[model samples]
Target: MRFTTRVLLLQLLTVVAVVATSTAVFIGLSMAQLRDEAETSALMIARTVAAEPEVRELVAEEAQDEENPPAEELAQGQLQQYAVAASQSTGALFVVITDQNGMRLAHPDEDLLNLLVSTSFSEAMEGREVVAWERGTLGESARAKVPVFAPGSDTPVGEVSVGFERAGVFDDLPRKLLFIGAAALLALVIGLIASLILRKRWEKLTLGLQPEELVVLVQNQAAVLDGVGDGVIALDTDGVIRLSNGAANRIFGILDSENLTLADLDLADDVVADLEGGTARDGVVANGRVIFLEARSVDRGGQALGSVIVVRDRTDLMALSERLDSVRAMTSALRVQRHEFANRIHVAAGLVEAGRMQEATEFLHTMRSRGPVDYPLVGVELITEPFLQAFLGAKSLEASERGVSLQIREETLVLGNVAEVEDVATVLGNLVDNAVTAAVASDELRLVEVTLLDDADQLVIVVADSGPGITPGADPFAHQPKKLAENDQDSGQLKDHIHGHGIGLTLSQDMAQRRGGEVWLVEPGGEKSRRGAVFGARLPDVMEPDDSVNYREVQEEDK
Candidate 1:
């Protein structure tokens, strides 16, 4: 059956049951009360007939005789007349007067007079009134027996018995039952009307969907929402969160999504603003993860529904981009060194061909001792790791090309192989790139200083420049990109990654934090500062290694 029909039927059945039970109880009590009324009326009539003064006098006279005598004609006639009148007035079936010996003196039928009564009369003769349903010569009835007394007499002179027919007592009961049945029917009708109204309301509340449809909808939601890898958040028109996927919960680091809203989550202001604006936003940082979000308004039949937000985590992609930048910087420096070496070789060849053999030998010796492209200004002699040495050399060359000086501090010392060199390079490389950009923009000397320290337990890199420090009233480690958009061009990061939208410092901080480390600004590069901004990144558990693998040896072994 349809759910609405079933509900209506149930309501009708409940009303019927209640009405039936109540009617039965009421009818039972009414029948009892009517029967009692009949018995009481019969008893009252019998007593009144027995109390007549003339009949009492005649009965007393008749009893005065010593010998047993027949009922006195005058007394019996008067008693019979009175009985007839009482029976007619009270609507009793019959009225009978019997002497103390149980011989009837007055009866409804004249032939029954002077006959022995068919039912018990002993209790009435002994001065006790009796009332019960009994079978007698008059037929079945609710009968009452009362003792008749003479004037100032304690003894019963005779007994008066009155009866109401069994059928007559319940004559009006059928009409009452008809009314009660009608009331039950009326109640059922009211209940059905209420059920119909309720059904309409229920349909509206459920959006005209049935119970089975609702169940299927819930099941589909669970299967689809939790299965997707990308995070999904759905909101109503009022910005209330209606649905949030498991991936969204994980991305926001929330334990429960119940009663959650966009404002309740610790999302970056830029990301939230973009979502509210109903536009697609890329490179938005949230919860230390590079997030790209697409927000689009949903509608049904041109009616506004709400919005759905899709979030993509791009932290790993941004890290890779930073590493690629480092490699590119190194490649450019190698090309410069290779071109310089080629020029030196050509010069030595020309000198030898001129027969100046001693000058060519000294020239080759000098080139070998000093090494080609020795950037003497940056203090590269103190750094020993080839990768770091080459990477910093490339950065210095790149800086000089941009008209900015890149300097390595004299106190910097890193003597062992870094276990995670790519991670370290990503952090320091971004810092150097940003510093170089800032130095190029500064009016003071265009110089950038770098400090690398590996103190066995941790790796620390500090980059300071001659440019203005960080923007005032900004937390350097925060994921806010407002300062970067205002003052920097994302430090010239990749175009595709969200971190490229000015999260360089945030990316470095996230990488360091992953290894139980931190990144912070030692000085804000603004107008009030003597020097440029200085940023420091410290990574714990970045210890020195006992041995290092050579790229060439590994390739030769594979061959």
Candidate 2:
């Protein structure tokens, strides 16, 4: 059954039980009162008959006789007179007298006067009043007996027994009690029904609210927050975490996705300190990286509850801003160079016009060959040796300018037509650029190691940088993008903008992913090195010969 129905049933049954018990108690009390009243009325009638003067006179005359004459003679004379007078005065069924031995002395029926009376009458003749309700010769009756005394003496003579036919009078009380009991029972049933109806209505009204509703609301809200990229952490009043979305969990390194607790994440001391202090703070870390941490107090009903901590990855944001600054700088420098080049072209044109053709040709050749480095990083087959030499040489210069030493430890392997030459260059260029930037702050021994190896199945390029290693924390990619700053004017501001660095790493990571490879940090550990970061890029090698290749052959070649 539904919960509301069950509750209604329970309440109805409880009401019914209480009503039933109370009704039974009331009926019992009424019956007892009725019975007492009936008995008292019967006794009063008997006493009234016994106190009559004629009834007393007859008893004294009976006592004067030596032998109480046979009841037949007394019934025809003195008993007749007493019975007529007493019955007339008192509204009794019959007035009968019995001697000490229970022989009827005077009776309303002459024939019964000769019959011996029951022991109850003999007991009554000995000066005891007896009242009984029973089925007698006159049908259902209430009978009472009172002893009579002699006129001038204190001696009892005979007993006067009065019986009132009570099938009507006595039955009146029980009938009325029965009517009362029936009415009470009906009222109890009606009250029980009304109570049940009210209880059911109340249960229906309360059905909409349940504890599970709260749980569902919480889960849905948390799921929506999880879809956001920014890290969000909510806590209760006891400094315990109540909600942590995916972004927050990633930023804090909390592993359990289903059941998470505050103590399991092990947040950094700085972050925890800010949380406890209940104040918003932003600062840079020792790694030349910037982090913005904000703490806001949560409240309910004007009472301070707990605090929420939001942590944002600002590394990319700072980098993009720096890139914008660099672009502006490069634009200004290019403008100056453009003006200088225009003047030189004017001077060179004058020389050619004055017939110094050799000098003019040489100047033109130098200008054509000495342009900025421009080459497609992907989708290329064979290149001119001069172009190759210039490109490689420029990469070396670029590394040196950034305070980084870059070296190719091994010769590049040609993986046949299956390997896209331009793709290789693009992947390597990005990786090398990132390595150089990361190692810029390193000591004299700062070096970026680049290695390329090709096997039957895949070509692997490894770029290792000598710098502070990647910290152990949550996965950055798993979280959604943070909300864009309201004051930001550029689309790049929505990206992960760290405070200190440029956008090289984030751009390189995106390129790596697009090429169907992953960029991961490996802890450089051994007796030779304390710690650094190594990033590896693996791409499929799909070289094919003139003949078809089998799976077994490919496996054997890979081995």
Model 2 misplaced stretches (Cα beyond 4 Å):
1-234, 241-259, 265-269, 279-295, 307-398, 408-410, 413-434, 437-446, 452-460, 465-498, 501-516, 521-533, 539-559
List lDDT for all candidates, in order.
Answer: 0.77, 0.57
Q: By summed lDDT, which 10 consecutive residues of candidate 1 come out lowest?
A: 489-498
Q: Quick one: best TM-score, which candidate?
A: 1
RMSD of each: 6.6, 14.0
Q: For model 1, give the RMSD to the true fold.
A: 6.6
Clash count of each predicted structure: 7, 16
Off by over 4 Å in 1: 10-168, 171-175, 268-277, 296-307, 333-377, 481-500, 525-528, 541-543, 546-559
Worst 10 residues of 2 by lDDT: 375-384
How well is each residue in 104-155 modelled by candidate 1, as lDDT tens digits? 7778887767778999888987899999999988789999998877668978
The digit string of per-residue lDDT tens for model 2 on 435-539 reads 665465345456777665556555577777675444345232221134324422212211223332233344445445656665554543222464345767776
Model 1 pairs in collision = 283-498, 468-525, 469-524, 469-525, 469-526, 470-524, 470-525
